[model samples]
Target: MRLRELLDATELGLLLLVGHDTDDTDDNDGIPPGTPLDRTISAVATNDLSDPGRFLTGGELVLTGLAWWQGDGDAESFVRVLHRAGVTALAAGEVEHGLVPHDLVRACRRHGLPLIAVRPETSFAAITEHVLRRLHRRDPGSLAGLAALVERHRRLLTDRAAPDSVLELLRHTLGFDVRVLSATGRQVAGARPPLRAKTAAALAARYLAARRAGESAPHHVTVGGRPYSLVPVPAPAPVRVPVPGPGPLPHPHPHPHPAELGDWLLVVEADTSLWATPDRELLDRTVELVADARAAREQANTARNDLADRSLALLHSDVPAEEIPLRLRSTAQAVVSGVGYWPRLQFVVAAGEWHAARPVPAAALRVLLEEALLQEDGPVPVSSEDIAATVDGDRAVLLVLVPGPSEAHPDPALDHAALERRLSAALARWLGPADSVSIGVSSPVPEPGNARRALEQAHNALRIAHAAPGQVTVRGPEDLTSHILSLLPLIPAEARRAFATRLLGPLRDHDARHRTDLLTTLETFLDCDASWTACAARLHLHVNSLRQRIARIEHLTQRDLSRLETRLDFLAALKSG
Candidate 1:
């Protein structure tokens, strides 16, 4: 707090005795004309001891009754000790002496201590109470309101209230909308018509960058045609799991989780740089409250995690084929899980490494997979149609069931390519610059007995992904449909690159400059045997559109698509690339 605020409170009848040279003007309501206060007061101390240095800490506005001073020399010595104690100012009361001694003012000036005089009408108790109240930037009543608000939020969580309900309460109290977001562009909870996916992704990037730079938040950004303030929610405290050992007293918390990548974020539409101190504190409280809610939700998922463990064990163990579907009949999957429904499994095998940080936990990847699988538009659900577990250390296996609400449900096939795209994006949110993950996606299998083959396929794709470039790489069933892909990885990467780049470099460059999908179009056309009707139908384009694109491709690459050798050459290049 500033001394100026205290002096400006006219009822306090406080006067600046030193630190300013100003005319005693009545025009400013019995106050001085020039600006006087500069330094800030951290706290208020009331003392009357001759040697009050021992009683004081720094930046205190020392309140006294002149009981320690008897003469000019006494004043100088007293002031010297007060200065030594690092007090910001001295406010001597006149009740005992009937006046502030001129010697005290001279000593204070000599020691460069600002002197404030407390009028007899204002009690020292009044100044102490006032400064203490202002220290927190809010009165006790306002502080109580914040505490009460927190209590209400906790009650909401206990009652199993929706996250949005609590967020709505905050909107009413804060007079602003606050959103909760994850690193993968999923709006965990917040205001209506939640931030666009692209906007959330950009905000997450800024939040992570700010944290990596050791910069304080709320970080400011302009996205979705408006400015927003973002603050990283506190990373959940590492939970210490007991080590399983023969010893009765094993080392505690052997594997505490302190995963840094997938943090929750608090977002506000207003620019926080212009907010008041109290508002900033409120924003900080938002982070804390949101973090607490997230923790509670995660804790509630312990049962689901156990089910995943059992289900994945059944898939891997030498159990009967029929036993797998029965084990999978649980709430872990978002499907009906009814007796009539059969389970279809899509295996995702993901493994990653972190150089100087904690290893990415299998549970963390499970959470990311869930985020990639299900999106909640009404109430946020943590996981649905997704069950994941760690098979070996650091390798997470996610089992996603193609949801069939009823036995008659069509469109039950999982879109492998779309899943690859979503999952790669999701993992990017969790991997740092030095971190890399290899993700392998298996083709969906119809029967529980086929899960073993599906698992093997996933592992094969994972091996390919590990050999590929980039920190986050995904290799799925679609990428391995051809037998050539299996042998392509055995070739030297340099040879593969030289061959592909030579044949496909022109098309790649043309597509890059034009933002066209000519390369993909060319691949689809060759796969369809250059049949314009078939390629057009598969690409969701008209036959004429296909013709025009093929002509452009031929013009760019100087190759005739009608020739069998040319088509084979492009096909090989696409596979190698």
Candidate 2:
């Protein structure tokens, strides 16, 4: 409140000589001096004192006693000072210094100074007290009122009544509009009337500038000639919980939104000085509510994503293989809408102990994968957990289910090469130098029931990834041979091991006795399929030596090399080994 404005309401014996407005007389007009001065007084004194420039401009009750003069010679000088200083009125004290000084009265009447006489017992302190009370009528009575409002607003927001409701409450009760924006200054929610845009823009800009300078710095802005104070809310990272560290400090960047991205701001705007004690307190509470809500929302999203991922894993197993396509379709609809039909299906998986420790938080991971798939400028659907992703035709599908094809891009023209590069780079940036991720991609196969096969193929490629070094995507059916063998549905683990032992028992014993090169020779010969020259070239041996080793093996095992059964047994043993 400006001093002039405060004084205007004080109605104590205030009269104006250089009055520009018609209502210059004190509000308590027609009242005599002895009638207890009941009004607030604020009269501007035009009279010059020792320091001529210190005149009150627009206050009530400017008093003059001709006290600055001793007689006639001084009286006229005093009147000249009063006129030049722009004093509104001069009250001449009679009893203290005798009846109104003749020269002073004559000067006041000549200059039209609304002059009054003060009695001997009048105290300035009594008048000052009356004025103070009137000026403070609307302000919060005590500090507690401000503190209470701040806490109340915080609790109201925590009740989960959307942000809009909170803003409405503030506007209705506080008589000002509110706006919420992201860290990037993008408006989240708020009223933006055309009339208030300029004012709002200026205030918002100033507040943001101050916040950027130092988030903890509180700023005051005047919009539409009305003052407003803005304080920034600190957005903490999702992983940063209230653990023991150096407790919470104001963020250097005063972005009202969450610092970790994808958060919002809580901006409160009100008339200057109208942000009573109560409003300031409520603002504090609002900040806490927003931070807690953001944190809770992040957690909920993580849990939901976890459940979806687990559901997908369940769909991948337990269910009969043939039902995979149907299952994928159902899950796809549940996770992302408008997705149906899949042409080419490729499965990919990343594994290792390193992957476990710093696993992508479910929501963040989901978002990253979705962002890669969608390439959209808007919000991407990612939970705060792990990134389990799928791609269907046009829609980069996410959420867990059988690796299936989508109708949008039915031709299973899998971009195996491009996808491998993307996965490598994304994981590299995400995991940093400490971790390693091995991605195995299944060759794009025909759609429908083959979804399960594609997933199995990808899984197999991942299993044998060690064999192919420096590779992220181990694709194609060949990479998964070991897995194929396991899926034979005919040979149990123990039986397969026993069979491998029986067939290679002769060669094992022979090698053990003579330290012979029989196993190498057999593997090479079998790889060459009885071609002596090629087998010898591969073994780096003379053809004759190779023949001798082969003959010795045959003699010991009692299985002729020329026979189909003997060759089949050797081949099976080699495969198992």
lDDT of 2: 0.47
Write down the worst ten-residue block by lDDT for model 2: 375-384
TM-score of 2: 0.32
Predicted structure with the largest lDDT when compared to the true one: 1
Using all chains and alpha carbons, the TM-scores for the candidates as numbered come to 0.52, 0.32
TM-score of 1: 0.52
Candidate 1 lowest-lDDT run of ten? 25-34
**Highest TM-score, which number?**
1
Model 1: how far residue 187 lies from native, Å: 0.6
- Across 1-577, the per-residue lDDT of candidate 2 in tens digits comes to 2233323443444322222223233332332222122223332221224333322332234444344657675656665555554444455555446666677666655554445555455433333334334434544654353345445655755655445544544443333556665433334455454224334435444554554344443456666665555555444363222212233424343222212222244555543344335546656665566666555545445543543464447555788754766776565446443555542334555443122233223322233333233211212222223234532221122432223335754323334454455445433322323333344555443444445544554555655663454524334444454444454447676876787788788889889899988988888876554546557777899977987998898887878775434654677677775
Model 1, residue pairs in steric clash: 334-385
Per-model root-mean-square deviation over C-alphas: 19.3, 24.0
